[model samples]
Target: MNASRTPLFCDTVLAERIERAEARLMAECCEAAQRGDSPGFVHVLAGGVASFAEDGSPYNKVAGLGFHGVPSAADLDDVEKAFAAHGAVVQVELAHLADPAIGVLLTERGYRLESFENVLGLALDGEYEPVALPGFVIRRSGDDEFEQWLEVVADGAAHPDTQGLPWHEEFPREIYLRAQRHSAAAGEQHYVAVRDGAFVGGAGLRVSEGIAQFAGAATAPAHRRRGVQSALLAARLADARAAGCDVAVITTQPGSKSQQNAQRQGFDLLYTRAVLVKQP
Candidate 1:
């Protein structure tokens, strides 16, 4: 029997680039929230907004009640009520300066803490080193190659913990399909990593306003532990530089492997955010 090859992980610099890409996304989400645009924020949350808060969504799953801003103690009741009415989850973000007591209040009221994350960023002008993985091939993904990309996402989804909180079962399918459409419309680059003509992993790079955000990075189950992710990231960063981005940003859970992954690639934590989950 052939021995299983060990999956490769990213080094410090690539991790930093991933975190930098996350930062750009967080800023966009925060900006949408500040504008009181529920639909806009959800789209950002969905990786990109295709349709705005379409009516009759089960669980207001689309709106993600109270995600826009902090709700007052009294307002929390109303927000919870609204969430219950829609059979959905209500989330609130407390910044570093927010009182720690808020968690106690939520727990006392039956709301559980869902997750925490450290948002990281790197100036577009910051220096980043490129690492070469000679055997793997990375290149732009075209319309014909999209199904292979989807397969990696679907395979990764088998692990719920690794799949990320499922916003919608159809969300990923829609996002992947629509992203290609949008990128084609906008003339952006979507990339895939192949080893001997077989897809190993992929990432999306969109440059807007001089910043590049990395989205939809995934490696196949058989390809995990190999340097696929690291190689894909390095390729993306070089692409970001070639496109003239001034900075990169990404958001990640503080203690999760993703965080460690970002640090392994050299990302510095820019800030931390708490997403408070309450029972509806």
Candidate 2:
């Protein structure tokens, strides 16, 4: 750490950069998933991307909107039509820092409020030390261990910690696994935790545009209250700094355990997004 160099803080420019990176990653995941047997759909817009991973899949939504100024009505129409083609509802995650006019447009278009997600950030300009976990081993997952990692992560997601707001909905186990695979294919780095030679937790990290995205992570039901998640978070932060990321980010249900964990790890509440939905 340079004593003379000032620490990084979240500003409009930084927020926009992070949000745009997230949007791009979402699009990439959609494209990567489409290459598989599932055959999903992706719609690219000037403001963001709309994706449809599968029927009733959580990836079926629009992200990265309102940052490039308000999106045109015609573009929104096109996005809606794309999802409607699959008999799916159009779900939009709009950042609060975005142009307010975009929210107005969505309201006029009959998009109703759904939920909010908080995006927290940690500046990676300084050094990050590895987290310590007694009786636990943590390391990046190998390609051959993907199935084991997926099983642990899915089980963790199915039974989230009760520290904060719950998720709006849950996807089927198979669909969730597919989403995880697509994320991995989109350059997400996977990390696993083990205790007594058994996989106990799994997490993911992705770096794009100097941003390290702390993707979803979960611990085995029996591993909660331990330092598995904190260790995984630290490991990713250290790796992201090594990768030269300017900031690290994670999104979670407002006030959830994930949010609490990030905060405890020195992350600040940078901004939030409103989840709006319009049915076909």
User: Mind giving the per-residue lDDT tens digits that candidate 1 earns over 44-128?
Assistant: 3322111222122211221222123333567556556655654566655433333356556656767665556565544545444
Candidate 1 TM-score to native = 0.59
lDDT of 2 by residue, 1-280 (tens): 2345444567778878887888888788788777885556777766678888878777788888766777778988888888888898999888888888988999999999988889888888778877779998888999999999999999999987887777776888888988888888889889999899999999999999899999869998888978789999999999999999989999998888788888788788888889999999
Pick out the ten consecutive residues of candidate 1 with the lowest summed lDDT. Answer: 46-55
> Each model's C-alpha lDDT?
0.51, 0.85
lDDT of 1 at 277: 63
* Count of steric clashes across candidates, in order: 27, 0
